[model samples]
Target: MSTGLAELHEKARAALDPVHYDYYAGGVGDEVVLAENEAAFRRLALLPRVLRGTPTRDLAVDLPGGRLDLPVLIAPTAFHRLAHPEGEVATARAAAAARTVLVSGMASTVAIADVVTAARSVDRDASVWFQLYLQPDEDVTACLVERAERAGCTALVVTADSPVFGRHRRDAEHGFHDLPSGLAAENMRDLPGGPPGGVRDIVMSPSVSWEHLDRLREATALPLWLKGVLHPRDAELAVGHGVAGIVVSNHGG
Candidate 1:
């Protein structure tokens, strides 16, 4: 097993196909945000409360969906199958074993039900949240939400950024346009406008607005958390809109 992220990344780089590795490693534009995220972590300093006479402390914290043993959560990342055959199923089980949340991506190679099942098999109270980009088509969005709900997801993480797909130079140079044959975004199967077993491509729209979010809020009883809110004004809007939580992210640059 890898001892640290650098070692893990080196192992992954050695094991994965070059094109697939680049697709997973690279980020949008010049990748400034990705560098900054790394820098931020490096700058993190945990100051110990010296001389405190506490015998023990609990790290568990309760969020809208479930209680987490640690504050850290596994954020949504697409196409886990590109890295391993077990894909998100393996990830879900690991997250459950860690006693934290796994925000499963909408673009996961494993279906949401299977992902949740894998997690629950490890820890019965494991929480799996669904992360999605709201489609321009309301029916499609609703259908996706219903799928998450049916799959036993505890929360919905709405990724509000990426009105358009980012320009990943590495992917473009490597010609990584689609998944390898046999692997697909499993949760996208049988969406609104498609035939039986037909998967609808996820569409990003510049026209998506707060009104779309309002409609979504009315549609589901699950806790709704907004991701990709970097601006303070947008964060304020999210709070006013009854969001259970806000994840201020720059999509890892």
Candidate 2:
């Protein structure tokens, strides 16, 4: 890790509860992918143009969803309240201030509308995309898409990597299975097959396929982005399915 990031990680470790820290830091299985991700990033070299001194440089970009003042974006991460009290709300605010996209997680501790409101409080034109995993129950999946639409998300980020939960050895060792008291995934409340005020658990299934993506595309007018596609064939398939974009990711691997 870079010196700055290492310092930040150390601070987070020092401040957060052990279980929560492990939940945030640990990846699936023995975390070989995690090590490799860092290794891969280190090997990359950005060759800057030399001898053409400009007064200022612009890093802005325009995507189908919205214009970004910087090329950087804040990708989705789940259950942020465990890390800080303000959680996704604070994250939204920061992203707004930076004039970049904040792909709010489906498993956010705060509700989607509240997160969007928080971002708008900083910049009215701020773009906040919703990140979701397709549920086995189509009704539940549709409900999530509706929620995102109602909350004013500019685009939908469908995470296609996690067909099933990966085995995080650290989490298993630390016995970190559930959120602490009073902190639930707020977006899951009042879902199908639950009490009026109950929250349903998010489900993952290997049965999810391109047909499901097709249905989702038909359901929402918002730009749809497919996340966690690493295979070239899968990328081609995504294009065939008419996704607005493909986020090349390995689900943090």
What does the lDDT read for residue 55 in candidate 2? 82
Residue-level lDDT of model 1, residues 1-253, one tens digit each, is 6699899889999999999999988988888887889899889988877877889888899999989999999999999999999999999999999999999999999999999999999999999999989999899999999999999999999999889999998999988899889998999999889989987798889999999999999999999999999899999999999999999888878
| Each model's backbone clash number | 0, 0
lDDT of each: 0.94, 0.93
Estimate TM-scores for all models. Answer: 0.97, 0.96
Show where candidate 2 strays beyond 4 Å.
1-3
- Candidate 1: which pairs clash? none
Colliding pairs, model 2: none
RMSD of 1: 1.1
